[model samples]
Structure formats: C-alpha cells, structure tokens
Target: MEIRKATEKDVREITTIYNEGIEDRIATLETEVKTDKYVMEWLFQREKRYLVIVMEENSHIVGWASINPYSHRCAYRGVGELSIYIKREYRGKGLGQNLLLALEKNGQQNEFYKFVLFTFSFNDLGQGLYRKMGYRKVGVFEKQGIRDGEHVDVMIMEKLLG
Candidate 1:
C-alpha cells in the first residue's frame, strides 16, 4: 500500500472511509455523512497545516488520516487535533499506524509542536494505537456525551513533538 498526500480527487474516497467510521459509531460523534464539497473546502482552507493522507492499494483507498485545528486562537496555532480511520475491512492491517506516522512527520514539517486527539472510553483499539505511538492520556471527560441513550466517556490524549 502507498501512503501519500490526498488531493481534491481523493476527497470522495476519503469521505467514504470517514463515513464508514461514522457509521460504525466507534470513531466519532458525527453521525451525518459528509459530502465531497465540504471536505474539499476543508482541504483548501487548511491545506497549509491540515493534512489528509490516504493509504491506497490497487487504486482503492483503504484508510485516511487528518489534522485539524485544535483551537482558533493564534496562541494555539502550534497544536492540532488528529484523527485516523481505516476501512472496516482493512482495520487489522496496520494502515492506521502508517497513516498516523505519516501525519506526525507531516505535522512536524509544518512546525506543529503538539498533537491531540480524543477517543471514546470503549475504543480500546484506538486507545492502544495512540499509546503505542507515545500519546499520553491527559484526562477523561466523564459521561461527556450520550449516544443511543447511552452515556459515554471520552479520553483526551496528547503527544508532544519537538
């Protein structure tokens, strides 16, 4: 598989991969499916620091990773929020790790000093991936959200980069 920077043409497949993560209800709180136009706008607007990396094999997009604004304030410009998702069928293949490592390297090149992400308490796989990458759990927002009438906690994780 090849890991590379995503272009406008890749938005649709990236959206598909992200929607799959949303549908699974394990990776994100966003339930609405995204459109290519929206993702395209995001890519253009944040292209300088934000990234969309895709893992491709045989011309099929198998996974993606992204970095977004952690905060809008100027003082927080050096920090970014990250997310990585792989196609459901590709989950066990370490694609997420490859995508994340690429993002980290890209982030450092872009002058980012820190990366942050949050995962649901029940998402052990995601948490383990973050831990293996040297991310530390800084805090937990207890009962921070409710989905399907069930309360869930969110773990906040961070990794420092020089």
Candidate 2:
C-alpha cells in the first residue's frame, strides 16, 4: 500500500469511505452521508489548515487520515483534531495503525503540538488502536450521543507531539 497526500481527485472516493463510517454508526457522530461536491468544497476550504492523506493499494483507496484544527481560536492553533477511516473490506490487517503513524509524522512535521480525537466508548477495536498508538484517554462524555436508539458514551483521546 502507498500513503500519499490527498488531492481533489480523491474527494469522491474519500466521501464514499467517510459515508461508510457514518453508516457504521461507530466511527463518527455524523449521521448524514456526504456528497462528492460537498467533500470537494470541504477539502478546498481546509486545504491550508488540514493535512489529509490516503492509502492506496493496487490503485484503490482503502483508508484515509486527516488532521483538522481543534478549534478556530488562536490559542488552539497547535492542537489538531484527528480522524481516520478505513474501508469495510479493509478494516483490519494493520491499515489503521499505519494511517495513524503517518498522520503523527505529518502532524509533527507541520509543527502541530498535539492531536486529539473522539471514539465511541463501545468501539473496542478503535479504542484499542488509539491506546496502542500512544494516545492517552483523557476524558469521557457519558451518553453524549444516541446511535441506533441507544445512548453511547464518547471517549476523548489525545497524543502530544513535538
């Protein structure tokens, strides 16, 4: 697999992958699927502030990772909110780990001081991956959301970078 910076041409596939995450209801709080045009616009708007990368194998996108601003406030400029999504068929086999490592490398290179993210408390695999990646679980928001008619807690994790 090859990991590289994302370009406009990647928006469609990226949107598809992200929609998969939404459909799963375990990866994100977003419930609506994204459109290609919508994602393209988002990419353009965040091009300067975010680092987005995709993993391709045999010319097909299997996973993606991104570092977005934690907040618009200047005081949080060095903090980034992270996200990672892997296609369902390629969910395991270490792709998520690689994406996280790549994002960390890019984050530090870009002078980001830290990265943070939220994962559903019941997503054991995701939680384990974050822990294994050296991200500390800082807090939890109990019953922060409702998914599939059930209340879900969200775990907040952070990793300090140079």
Candidate 3:
C-alpha cells in the first residue's frame, strides 16, 4: 500500500469511503452522504496549512485522512481538527493507522502543533485505533449529536505533535 497526499482525482474514492463511514454510524456525526462537488469544494477551500492524505493499494484508495482548522480564531491556528475514513472492507486492517501517521506527518510539516478528533463514544474500534496511535482521551460530551433519531455521546481525543 502507498500513502500520499490526496488530489482532486481521488475524490470519488474518498467520497465512497466517507459515505461508508457515515452509513456505518460509528465514525462521524454527519448523517448525510457527501456529494463529489461538496467534497471538492471542501478540499479546495482549505488553507495551505490544512492537509489531506490518502492510502492506496493497487491503484485504489482504501482510506483517507485530513487535517482541518480547529477554529477560525488566530490563537488556535496551530491546532487542527482531524478526519479519517477507511472503506468498510479495509477497516481493522491497519490502514487507518497508516493514514493517520501520514496525516500527522504532513500536519507537522505545515506547522500544526496539535490534532484533535471527535468520535462516537461507542465506537470501540475507532477508539482503539486512536489510542494505539498515541492519542489520549480528553473527555466525553454527553448527547453531543443526534444520529438515527437518538442522541449519542461523543468522545474527544487529541495528540500533541510537539
């Protein structure tokens, strides 16, 4: 497998993997599936400090990760919010770990000092991957988001690149 920076051409696969995560209802709070145009706009609108990466095998993108602005405030410029998604068939095969590593590396190169992510409290697999990657649990937000007509707790995790 090869891990590298993501480009516009990879949007289709990225969208597929992201939709899979949304459909699984474990990786993200977003319920609506993303369209290619939406994803493209999201990708191109990011500042230079924000980075997106993808993991591919045999010419197919299996997973993707991105670092986004944690906040618009200047004081939080060094902090980045994290997003990661692996195709359902690729989950638990260590692809997420590799993707995150690449994302962190690129983040650091772009001057990011810390990375934070939010995951559903019951997402044991995702939590395990984050913990194994040296991210620490900050805390849980009770009823943070609504998924499937029910409120679900969200856990925040962070890692300092320094």
Candidate 4:
C-alpha cells in the first residue's frame, strides 16, 4: 500500500470512500451521498497550505484524510479541522493511523499548530484510534445534533503540534 498526496484525479475514489463512511452512519452526520463533482469543487478550494492524502493499494483508493480550515478568522489561522475515513473493509488495519500521522506531519510543516476533530460518542473505534494517535479529548458536546432521528453527542479531540 502507498500513501500519497491526493490530486483531482483521486476525487472520485475519495468520494466513494467518503460515501461509505456516510452510509455507515457511524462516521459522520452527513446522510446524503456525495458526488464527484461536488467533492472536486471542495477540493479545488482547499487551503493551499493544508494537505489531503489518500491510501492506495493495487492502484485503488482505500482511504483518505484531509486538513481543512477550522475557522476563517486570521486569529484561528494556525488551527485546522481533520477528517479521516477508511473503506469499511480496510478498517482496523492501521490505515487510519497512518493517514492521520501523515496529515499531522504535513499540517505542522505547513504552519498549523493544532489539529482537531469530532467523533460520535458511540464510535469507540474512532475514539480509540484518535487516542492512540495522541489526540486528547477536549470536551463532549451533549446532544450535539440530530442524525437519523436520534440525538447524538460528539466528542471533540485535539492535538497540539508545537
């Protein structure tokens, strides 16, 4: 398996992997399946300093991670929000860890001082992975939002790069 920077050509496969996460209902609150065109447009507007990486095996994308703006204010310029998703079949194989490590290193190199992410409270696997990766649970937002007609709590995790 090879982990490399993602390009426009990889957006379709990335969208597939992301949609899998969306369908699982455990990874994200988003219910609508994303389209390649929509993903491509988002990718195009990504902050130039941040990084987007993909894990590929046999020329097929199996996972992806990205660091995006945490906020628009210049005071928050050193912070970024992280997102990672691996194809369901590829979970528990350290792919998420590897992808996150890459994103963290790349983000730090690009002057980001912090990386933050949110996970559903019930997603033990994801929380465990983030903890293993050195991310600390900053807080939990109770009844953060409603998804699929159920209220869900979200755990906020953060890692300082300094």
Instruction: List, residue by residue over 44-154, the lDDT tens digit for candidate 2.
Output: 888465888999999888999999988999899889999999999998678999999999888888778999999988888888898998999999999998888788899
Candidate 4 stretches greater than 4 Å from native? none
**How do the residues 95-159 of candidate 4 rate in per-residue lDDT, one tens digit apiece?**
99989988888887899999999999999998999999889999999999888999999999999
* Candidate 4 overall lDDT versus native: 0.91
lDDT of all predictions:
0.89, 0.90, 0.89, 0.91
TM-score of each: 0.94, 0.95, 0.96, 0.97
Better of 1 and 2 by TM-score: 2
Ranked candidates, highest TM-score first: 4, 3, 2, 1
Identify the runs in model 1 with alpha carbons over 4 angstroms from their true place.
none
Worst 10 contiguous positions by lDDT, candidate 4: 43-52
Top candidate, metric lDDT: 4
| Shift in Å, residue 56, candidate 4 | 0.7
Residue 88, model 4, lDDT: 87
True-structure lDDT of candidate 2: 0.90
